[model samples]
Target: MNTLNEINWFPGHMKKALDQIKERLKTCDGVIEIGDSRAPISSFPTYLDKLVADKAKFYIFSKADLADRNALEKHLDKYTALGINTLALNLTDRRAMQTLINRLSLVRTRQEERFLKLGFPAPSKRFLVLGIPNVGKSTLINSLAKKKKAAVENKPGKTRSESLIKVSDKVFIIDTPGILEPNYEDKNIVIKLAILGSIRNDILPLIPLTDYLLEYLLKHYPQRIYERYHVSLDGNCEEIYLRIAKERNFVSKNQSDSERARSTLLTEFRNGLLGGISLDE
Candidate 1:
């Protein structure tokens, strides 16, 4: 797998966002941390978790519509066993918003109890919404708010400021800019993030990222590619992609367009055309 050394992922804005989030956490009563369901464990930043660990936290696996159900449960169970309120939900699911609200009500109730015991007036339940880029933070906010209250985009790093949104009468959400960890020593983790589109599209090359995704599916979810692309997984990744290109007539004069083929593969995976695949392994 490519180590993704060429990606200029951490911009000055993200560094500044981290500092701003640290300061903003001071006013929040809880945290609603989102992560991609395809690579839930990897996309959940350990550093950010450490920062919000003391707060009443709810861990959400967004884009559950694009992840393997079995693999998703495996990941969710890991967090649940740690006693963290964890849920796997696709933003489009109508029930997701209510389920989330139910879980958050617990956080609010706990906050109320805390304020009572501490002899402080209990204000509205305030939660800081945070996660890596492209993790559906904005979309989730819009869903919770029951309107287009937050600017939502499919790309990474779209939302850039901290804003307070009133989702319900008794609950408020602090929306923060998505930020990656300052250091990513694990290349595999970065690769998974890229594969899941959590990393910015321009930050990493699609060829290498798709190649890693190729090898991963070949190893763990070969049936997915076979069913979706009708391509055999009997050879190296290059050979497999070429086979797909050949089968789909994605070629020029009998030669596969490497760029086009890789892009197609990545787009298929990202769009869930390859079925519910997971990079949790």
Candidate 2:
């Protein structure tokens, strides 16, 4: 097995965004940490804990619709046990979004109490939203604000700066660009984030990633591969890819197009065609 020695993806825009976030944290009432529910642990911006430890913190694990129900429930349970305010659900669900909005009432009340004690008028609640790359921070903000206030993209690093968008008359959210640690301490995290589309796919070798996904699915979700492609899960990753290539007619000349097979496998997983998958568990 090949291990990634290092993955340093911190760009110029990310540094600038971090600086702005630190400066603006003083004015914000709370912090909301967002991450992909499919790989919540890996996709999380764990580095932000130190920065937001002093403020009211909430965890919103997005894309819960695509995460394995059992695994997601377990993850949520662990967070709940820790006494951390955490929510795991689809970002588009209106009811879930309402629950999120309602939960923020406590944070807002606390901010107001602080302001009153300081002899200042209570200001609109400001929440600093932070997440790793491609974790749906903008989409959550858009859903909360009930409008297209932030740029929603499927790729990473789309939002380069923080934008204050009013979700309601008394609530404002500062959507910051997806920020990643300069380097991940665990290399497995890099692979997991890459598979979850939270990191750039081009940064790693495609074959290794595809193999990792294939092995994981075979072990934890063999039925998905069998049902989706009718391929036997008894073989190795290469054999499985070849079988899928033949099944999908991904052939080039006399040989199976392994590249296309790998790409398709990854795409299927990302789009949740294979089923609800949880890479974190």
Candidate 3:
């Protein structure tokens, strides 16, 4: 198994985002930590456990539609058992957005009651939605606002600044730009996997990462491999990628099959064509 140590990716803006988050933490009531459902462990920032220790916190497994449903359910069960208020939400779903709002309301009410018990004046409930780039934070906000207020894109680093939006009379959301870890050697691999759209099959140019994903998928979810692309597993990762290339009719100018078969496979995999596959599962 190739550990994710080879990939190196980190932007300078992440440090700025972290500083801004720290500056604004005092004004906020709690944090809504958003994580990619496909790779929750990788998507989460380890520093958050201490960063938001003084403030209330909630975890939202975002992009639930693309992740393995069973895996997500298991995660939810495990996290909930540990007393973490976790919610599995598909950001594109309107009803799921409503449910999330209601859950946030309940959490706020409980916190308000606790503060009241302590003889502290009840503060207005403010939540900051924090996540890495391209984890669907803006889309989630758009769903909640019921309008196209936040800029959303499939690419990473789209939201470069923080923007506060009022969702309701009692609930307000502070939308922060996606923050990536700085020089943290451990998470570099996971960041590259996410940028390559290893979670689903919408983006392309999937060469090295696609081969990695196929091998990983074949070893774990063989049934999904057979079901999605109708390819049998008889050989190694290279052979499987070639078989997919041949099946998809992606040929090069020299009458040779293009390497694009791997690219196409990756794109489809990221778009949920390979079924709701979760990398962490």
How should the candidates be ordered by lDDT, best one leading? 2, 1, 3
List TM-score per model, in order. Answer: 0.92, 0.92, 0.87
Model 3 scores a C-alpha lDDT of 0.73
lDDT measured at residue 167 in model 3 versus the true structure, 0 to 100: 75
**How many residue pairs clash in each candidate at the backbone level?**
0, 0, 9
- C-alpha lDDT of all candidate models, in order: 0.82, 0.84, 0.73
State the lDDT of candidate 2 residue by residue for 1-281, as single tens digits: 34476445676788888898899898887888997899878888888888887787888999998999899889889899998889887887766788888777656446688888999987778888989888888888888878788888888888876688877677778888888887777777888888888778777889998998998988898899899998777767888899889999999998998789999999989998999999976
Better model by lDDT: candidate 1 vs candidate 3: 1
Instruction: Quote the lDDT for 96 in model 3.
Output: 75
Off by over 4 Å in 2: 1-3, 108-110, 115-123
**C-alpha lDDT of residue 253 in model 1:** 70
TM-score of structure candidate 3? 0.87
